[model samples]
Target: MSLFEGLSAFPITPADPSGRVDTVALARVLNRLADARVDSIGLLGSTGAYAFLTREERRRAVEAAMATVGGRIPVIVGVGALRTDDAQALARDARAAGANGLLLAPVSYTPLRDEEVYAHFAAVAESGELPLAIYNNPGTTRFTFSRELIGRLSEVANIAAVKMPLPADGDFAGELDAIRSVTSPSFRIGYSGDWDCAASLLAGGDAWYSVAAGLLPVETLALARAAQSGDVAQTQRLNAAFEPLWSLFREFGSFRVVYVIAELLGLCKVEPLRPVLPLPDTARDRVAAALIVLRKHFA
Candidate 1:
């Protein structure tokens, strides 16, 4: 499989409230995903709290993940920064730490023009010198990539894939077709929204860049497999099992919910970085209830 294809589990970078990465806990999380045989590990992605972490800490997380995964699975480190140069430095750090690939989001303090975003991506891709997936997560980055820009970036060296949000119009096939029409045959396209990812896979998406898979790899992989095989009935059944969790993910955001999951699973005991509060008691109770529903199917 391509580095970007299949189920790419994006795990939380377990850390203390002060933002110091707990390499041991982080490795435990990666080991769980690796044991589940997720196709790839998306280290330092949004769920990993890459933005809140310092560059040194991000490097530590990548080194820890690469060590734990240890060539068994591809590790794609997220290298996003407000400044292009900082992002390039991060890409180089990831390469030095033996990351198999890179994921870059167009993060900015000021809104960026298309040309500027292109330049930022090109510079980071060149610096990383590894397969790079464009993270088109406008919800967090607040910058969307137009189809024309995606086509243009597909031509950039090392820019081999993209991680897109769920299409707004709910037409995964049409959106996939439109993007495939613009990019080369080898340039892969994937989606990150957990709720509708099975449909994306059924509609021919190359990957599921999944936050849910980070914590529920076994269950998520089953759904991915069902969808990828065009087993509509099976996919719907599995997706239904995940409905409660997906509802929690949408309500509280996967970033917060996954931390709660890690604690519930005994994988780690930590909170998200400050300013991103842990789910309040009421929402956390909902997450617990959601997990109970999932366990009925996967346990």
Candidate 2:
């Protein structure tokens, strides 16, 4: 089966009130998701506050997750860094630590041209034995890989899949169709930043990498299954129910609110990392209200 075939929960790295990674709390979150039957777990991705973590912290977080998951399901570690060598090294470390695959988010600095990005992936592929998935989140990287670039990278021996963050606006349907048409037939496309879960599936995403699913796995899995089964009504019902929580991302800039709400929901205990400040009192109140509404539907 393809690595991207089913629901994968992107668990936020739980941190203590002082902002140190709370390994015990993180293990609990992973155990709960495993119990919910999520197909896989992705560690240290954007939802996990990867950018804020020191290299050692990232390694420790993966170790904690692996201990909890313990071969029950595959783990895909996000390997993104300012330097190509660092990214490759992280990929190797993740593989050595028992990760089944690596998710490479494009390097942010220097804003590489398409060919350069491909070369970077090529280098990482050559360095690691594990399969690799390209994580394309233009909003974060400021450099979105073109379909042509993805097509080229898909040809790389170890490049297994592409994770495209569905654009918040513009012609997403057209964008998806364009991507589907251009990418290699073997390349799986998993939606990353999208929250319109049902609509994204209807539009033909093979799978979803969701932070919300970490908190409400059963509901998220049900929504994905319903959509996949072609039950439009049930899918819409679930999607509509999630609209309030989804709006949190729209109104407030970052996904920090969702992370905080996850904590409020008892899914994870991670606090927001540096520079990505905690939600303001007003935003916290808003998130609290949204969580109340979300629990009514998802719970």
Candidate 3:
């Protein structure tokens, strides 16, 4: 199976306001996912606030992840930057730090053409010397990838998988078929939106690049396994337990809500980086209530 297969838990890079990473707190969070035995750990992902951290801080985050859970689980570090050279450098840094795989997003201040994006990925894949997943995050990057572009990138050496956004038409099967027809069969396809990933799995998607799994790996893994097994009823039940949290994620963004989740669960106490404010008191109350629902179901 591809290293990207199954539930890849994405954890926050617990850092203080100065953007300095707290390796101890980070290791504690990673230990939870490692102990839960999640399929992989996606460090420095969007949920990890990769875009907000400098390359130095990003390298520190990857080093901490590998030290904590590197041998226990595959670690896919995000190496996205506004410039291709910078992304390539980040990829190299991740490889040197012992990351097992790489995730790259086309983060451009100006809009990037498809060819530019493809070349950027090719350069990183060549330099990184590790399996890389295309981070197809149009929501943040503002660049939607055409199916043809994905097809071309799949053939690139070391570009092994693609972390897709939820299909807008809500047709996982149709979307999967469209992308698969163009790409090689071994090129893994995965989805990121936490609420819709079970359906994506049930529809034969290769993986779930999950945010919630970062903190709730045990519960999230149960849901992913149920969907992978084609147990529709059990999948629905497990997903229901996460519905409240999903709603909160959609409302406040998982990036913001997860910091609160870590604190609420007593894993860590931290805030989102500046320009991305912490959730309000009312929203924190909602997040707490959402956790209650999940606890009741999983307990």
Candidate 4:
């Protein structure tokens, strides 16, 4: 529960042009977030380009993150894969790497059914003793898990929590209410669409699985803490300060903007994998301007 109780950062795995995981850059990013004291760090999540990494590269990325975080914070390694066997293999590797927990989405090429989704997680659950968090991202996976399905999955012993994307049209509170009414009491839930994070926290969601925190961990932490502590004024102020950046995320994909933002801030030099382009130059310029203003505002 502690892993999903606060700000959990999902950072991109920095890679060189060779598509190899850049251990040095990866270390710097992980160490920075660890120093900032995020509740947890997720290795090989969507933001980390999990699907793009080879099995070997994914293993090394988990190792690099664990090495840098060094038990300073819990590491939740993403073990999602298109096939159940690959997912189990990654889960085995994560357990070997001493990862604290696992995150999984029902990755699919063709669509998957409710029972098949349950089986996918059940298969991986048998692979290791590490706890599991279901990542329900329908947009990318093209497979959605309804509340009923989530409830059924929560019945599995190690399936501890779920990371749901923010509900659209400002219905975060309503969505939380509806989901909680159906799910088990022991199952924790949180938001992942970073734009609605403050609202999610204020609405009593369990965590913020943040992409922005990849580069600005401390700043994002401040926002989560303010909302979590019921500091309405502070939360509102920080949310407004981030509004422009959030707007950019809502326009250009957050996946794209994060790549540009990291390069813009000199945190790392990395690019999105093929089929996912980096931000266009014009969008990058606007993001650059927003980052400058945000830095000064945060300063």
Model 3: CA > 4 A from native:
none
- Model 4 reaches what TM-score against the true structure? 0.96
Stretches of candidate 2 exceeding 4 Å from the true structure: 16-19, 167-177, 267-270
Candidate 2: worst-modelled 10 consecutive residues by lDDT: 192-201
- Score every model by TM-score: 0.99, 0.92, 0.99, 0.96
Per-residue CA lDDT of model 3 for 1-299, tens digit only, reads: 68989999999989999899999999999999999999999999998999889999999888888888878899999999998889989999999999999999999999999989999999999999999999999999999989999999999999999999999999999999999999988999999999999999999999999999999999999999999999999999999999999999898889999999999989999999898999999999999999999998989
- For model 4, give the 10-residue run with minimal summed lDDT: 1-10
Residue by residue across 33-124, what tens digits does model 4's lDDT show? Answer: 99999899888898898888889999999888878786789999999999999999999999998899999989898899898999999889
- What is the per-residue lDDT of model 2 for residues 56-135, given as tens digits with 9 covering 90 to 100? 78888888888889689788999888888988888888877888888888867777788788889998987777888889
Stretches of candidate 1 above 4 Å error? none
Q: Rate the local accuracy (lDDT) of all candidates.
A: 0.93, 0.79, 0.94, 0.87
How many Å off is the CA of 275 in candidate 2? 1.0
Assess the local accuracy of residue 67 in candidate 1 as a C-alpha lDDT between 0 and 100: 85
Pairs of colliding residues, candidate 2: 15-270
Per model, how many backbone clashes are there?
A: 0, 1, 0, 0
Clashing residue pairs in candidate 3 (N, C-alpha, C atoms within 3 angstroms): none
Collision pairs in model 4: none
- Better candidate number, 1 or 4, judged by TM-score: 1
lDDT of 2 at 293: 76
